[model samples]
Target: MPVAGQTVGIDLGTTNCCVGVWRNNRVEIITDYHGRRAIPSYVAFNETERLMGDAAMSQNAANARNTIFGAKRLIGRKFTDPAVQSNMTHWPFDVVSGPCDNPIIKAHYKGEERHFQAEEICAMILMEMKEITEAYLEKEVKNAVISVPACFNDAQRQATKCAASIAGLNVLRLINEPTAAANANGIDHRGCEKNVLIFDWGGGCLDISLLTLDDEIYEVKASAGDTSLGGEDIDNRMVDYFCIGICEQILRDSKMPKDQVHEVVLVGGSTRIPKLQSMPSAFFDGMELCKRVNPNEAVTFGATVKAALLSGVKSEKLSEILLLDVAPFSLGVESIGGRMITFIRQNNHIPCKKTLTFSVCKDILPSVLIRIFEGEHSMTKDNNFLGEFRLDGVLPLASGQPQIDVTVYVDADGTVTVSAIERSTGKEKKVTVSHDKGLRLLSGRKRGHGYGTLEMYKLSD
Candidate 1:
């Protein structure tokens, strides 16, 4: 594909959004109309009109219920996920349950009820980035390379792609957040074949990746992350500490209705009391919150660097830069004893393959079970279940004989393919793993048999 004349790099982030354009063989961050390097990813609508960015963030105090923030955590997640339920506990806004139980942000704007899916909220931010790039480059901007956390799963990646579609921008690629940042920083140490670990700490997530750079190819060796750990976690800890101190102070004062006192004390500004500043400072050990990287703006700044590189505006000396990213979680199958036998570790290189051999515990095992799981945990129940498959007709083999060989391959796009062959009969079965919910959302696919309307399932629930 021919590169668009106005290609730009965008960091569509959780708390804030930024845009970068290539110029004079370097990348430049474009300030918004308000002359800010970062624009708050917030939107609000008062009875009179709609507002966005800085103006919208200011309303967080007065209209906390209507202001929308932190939609990134909700993106690409099902309503059934425990993570979603946990996030709802801290969000000040009203999150309405949607189809598939996904959380939808609802607010009143211009005297009318306004509803937005997580995708739409993110699309609005991307569209703002598009406008910033177009105005900065003084041309029509249509194509872009947007970055996402390496640990994001297939559903999350697809959700981001959907957001791009709704924003009317063509995504050149869904680059990994940390890899893009490394590119932005001119880290091309791969010629020496060194193994470098990239630790990405952002407002909403923490991703750690190890890569082996050799010859012009960057290959991921291992990757891991805690999606629920980031700057937000630190902030919540501070908030809770503040709440505790305030409760103590209230108790010291004259006794009042407990409910009334709780209402007055637990709101916004009380959470930011400077007198109890030890909470935030104590959370960070000697100003270093976590090892490997800082949680504040490392990922965002790194993303800006990547955006510049992809725009082709960076110097040719830097153009040869290549980044290889790995899947964030481990891939494995369940064994007879419910043990998860891992084949590919997170952050391993793309276009790679690994195989494992297993013997039938019984003389005539009729069927073999293939349970796929993702996570760093060695135990089967500790990881997320991706899908399952069954291979039949195991040749009547002696107990403890190697009857089947399973080969797993992961492509560059992060698709997983598994093949199982019976050694004695040579019978084989293969399948490409896919999320049941995501497959249904992709256009032009027939609904699976026995599947009913989404509403019917809701009614039964």
Candidate 2:
């Protein structure tokens, strides 16, 4: 029923999930047993067993407290996050802090209390999609290309990959939603140099990307979005809008004038809003918004193309496509004076590496603490803390004597590896940021311009 070595593409969305495959020289949207092309992103628990998709959504009215929806917003987020705090007020389900300060879903099922992490809930949804696709093709599927919001940080991207692993799916690649939409629009074969802007206003998030295309080479020049601005937010606030702000930010980041944009593409369900439909056109000075691709299936279509390319399918149209993505945020280490020294700036091409050298902050310091962070802020406290590691065996020399080189490497899949090396002694320590289980944060007051002693910090696990 299916060809050998088949791979699928999944658009794991905030409101629905869609799976597609590149077959018969075209993309086909796989439907579940009920013949539904799109499934609601819901999971629920009852006395007998668990329910997912439409069935879970049907009983949400009766089991509101146990039904978990909109888990995407909470994935890889701390309980103390302001977004989580704001969501607690509207969500019927219970969200509590775990030992690691991550949000955990509390529910009662089968006469017992159970706690499920956001990743686990996402895994359940992914597993359901896998089963649906398997049944459709009458063969087991293992590899997939998943899509995420372009604004997703390193932690969020890693958490999404972890969920795929839990569902027994090997991630071939994680494509940005807006980027995928550009692929669905078939911009690579347009046969000219053009600058395209993608406006992706979805159910729970808004992602905007500006890209340049020439000679089958597609590169993302800039990206900006807000997770809190979407269709649901419009229904909740009834008075706030973030489209103008996002447009300004994207223009500023790309350093391109509005008139220079050759084409504007619109995707996502929320783009159907009359006000939203006109916002992009107005911002681009009356440029007609391109609607060649179906808003609901654009992401899935792009993902399927990526899967086809990854699977080595012999399609002439996909043979020459080259994709070059960029990091969405800056990466760096905390330095003396509590400043953030960035080694990798936002919009830098992926699979790149950079290194910076520093000197000892204090005399006779046996070790130096390297605190990794992600953000655009100048101070360490204002940025998002990734993790920390101590590089020991320093030459125990006076301040500004020992030379320590810190290198940050990000692969094509957004995996981060940080290494610290002492030049004189050749001592080294390294860590993979995704596997970091705990974070060390400053707990004491700042004294002078140096990082305080190790004892003044506490473990956040």
**Candidate number achieving the greatest TM-score relative to the actual structure:** 2
Residue-pair clash count for candidate 2: 0
Best by lDDT: 2
Stretches of candidate 2 exceeding 4 Å from the true structure: 1-5, 187-189, 235-241, 435-461
Provide the lowest-lDDT 10-residue window in model 2. Answer: 452-461
- Which 10-residue span in candidate 1 carries the lowest summed lDDT? 261-270
RMSDs, each prediction?
A: 11.9, 8.4
Q: Which pairs, if any, clash in model 2?
A: none
Write down the TM-score of every candidate: 0.67, 0.91
- Alpha-carbon local distance difference test for all models: 0.63, 0.83
